[model samples]
Target: MTIHLANRVETLTPSTTLAITAKAKELKAQGMDVIGLGAGEPDFNTPSNIIEAAYRSMNEGKTKYTPAGGLPELKQAIVTKLKNDQGLEYAPSEIIVGNGAKHILYTLFQVLLNPKDEVIIPTPYWVSYPEQVKLAEGVPVFVEGKEQQDFKITPEQLEKAITPNTKAFILNSPSNPTGMLYTKDELTALGEICLKHQVLIVSDEIYEKLIYGDNTHTTIAEISQELKEITILINGVSKSHSMTGWRIGYAAGDKKLIAAMTDLASHSTSNPTTTSQFGAIEAYNGPQTAVETMKTAFEERLNIIYPKLISIPGVKCKKPQGAFYLFPNVKEAATLTGYESVDQFVAGLLEEALVAVVPGSGFGSPDNIRLSYATSLENLEEAIKRIHTFVQNKTK
Candidate 1:
């Protein structure tokens, strides 16, 4: 019997990054010593305080469903977080909490977009952004953030992409896949363009807390009140606090848009998990110690591993200012290693080197690859060593 699936099912493809990770797991199950660098989350456990809060909540019988948008208390916590961090204030009505940052984005698109509406997505993007736009019957317009400019798109590129159909522009600071951040001046330039065109801004700041060195995160909303009104800021505990399994994410924007997403979410997820919301409350309201500890460890590993990674023949990577991934342009490396494209080179890494990394084609960049350093120092070192040797051997 043939089953007819919805068109979205055909349009929304699976994640290529996850594909590499799954294949690496398959080889590892067969007893190969594979060091997978495709992780999208931190390797650390959820902080004990947060886990204890959730456990305490469930034990205290706070296990029932709360508001569909989110528990009011959780919304207040998010409001406080924004005020403290970005100086952007939001009423509870202007906030909506969903299962995760991804879920919040998916819901935002569902409520905000009509068929044929276009969202300007900067490449290389998080894998789900374009797919979610398609699922919502929206078109995704791509603007490249070239490697020469540290993978950050220029205001000129953004203005050129907007048309009458353009509805929103996604700004992922410390962007996934590339791990590059947009400075305040750069964001202001982009925001001015959005203002002139009346296009919305979707600021995905999931990695705001992971910045290294002197780099600081600036949400577009923070630049001015007008930008704040035009921006929907998305963030959650998944990365900042290593609570990926907690599945709590929220967005702050105009109340009307928030209400629409809340109504849509009521029909969809109903609410974020009861206990997880409790944990998220603690994540924002609790101590700052554990978050710093995990970030420090990631920086140490990056400092240690980056030089070795660049030592590989024909490989060039910008040291990431934030986020856990290192996206390197490997076209030269792939050619020197006798592969036709970066995709085949990625496969060769898994099959021959037993080191797994995501090909950048997944994020809309064909000549590069993304390696997540969200693993142990030991694991990252071993993976880089394997890749370096693989390129050297193939070149010989």
Candidate 2:
């Protein structure tokens, strides 16, 4: 019998980041020494305080379901965190917690988009954004962020992309592949355009707490009361608390939007993990010493490895202001190494040098490659050394 699947599933592209990580693991399972730089999560473990919270919750039999959106305590904790950190205020009714930031975003797209409605996504975006929009039956309009501008789109570009069918625009600061952050003035300029056009802004701030030296994270919704009303702010504990597996993320926006998302989640996920919610409650309210520790470590790694990566022949990169990834333009490196494309060069690096980094084509930048520096200083140094040697040998 020939079985047919949904057209949506057929059109979706699997995540290239996960694909590389899996291939590296497959080699390692066969006793090959593979060093993977493809993973997006922190290498650190979840803090003891957060873990203890989950254990306590389970011991107290808090394993049953909570409200579909989230537990009231967790929602209040998120509310408090937003107020204290971002200076943004939200009632619990305006926030909806889901399985993770990714899940929250998927739900947001589903509820906000109608068929053929367009979502403007800047290039070098997170790999999942366009795919999720397509899954929701929405079109994704791409706007390239020039490399010289630190891979950030401009207000002019935003204005050009808007059409009558443009429903929402995604803003991922301290962005996934590039690690570039938007300053306050830049965000205000973009916000004005969105407000003037009456387009919704979806701000993904999952990496807000991971900024490096002299760089700060700003939430666009906090720019003004009016912009706040037109924005949906997305965040979670996965990156900040090194709690990727805990899977707790929340969104705050208009009450009607939140309610719709909650309704859809109730039928789909029912609720986020009960133990994870308790853990996240503590993540938000507990002392933030662990978060600071992880941030410091990532910054230290970046300072150590970024210069070495740039020194490699034919490779150039701007120092990332935030996040733990370095997206280096490797087009010249690909040519020097005798490969026709960045993807081919990356494949050679993985198969020959046993170093795994994500190809940039998945992020809509085919001339670059993203290397995550979330691992130890020692591992980072080793990976760079291996990459340098591979490029030199291939070029010779």
Best prediction by lDDT: 2
Instruction: Name every residue pair that clashes in candidate 2.
Output: none
Give model 2's clash tally.
Answer: 0
Total clashes for model 1 = 0
Clashes of each: 0, 0
Q: TM-score, each model?
A: 0.99, 0.99
- Candidate 1 has a TM-score of 0.99
lDDT of each: 0.94, 0.95
Off by over 4 Å in 2: none
Instruction: Name the Cα RMSD for model 2.
Output: 0.7
Least well predicted 10-residue stretch by lDDT in candidate 2: 373-382
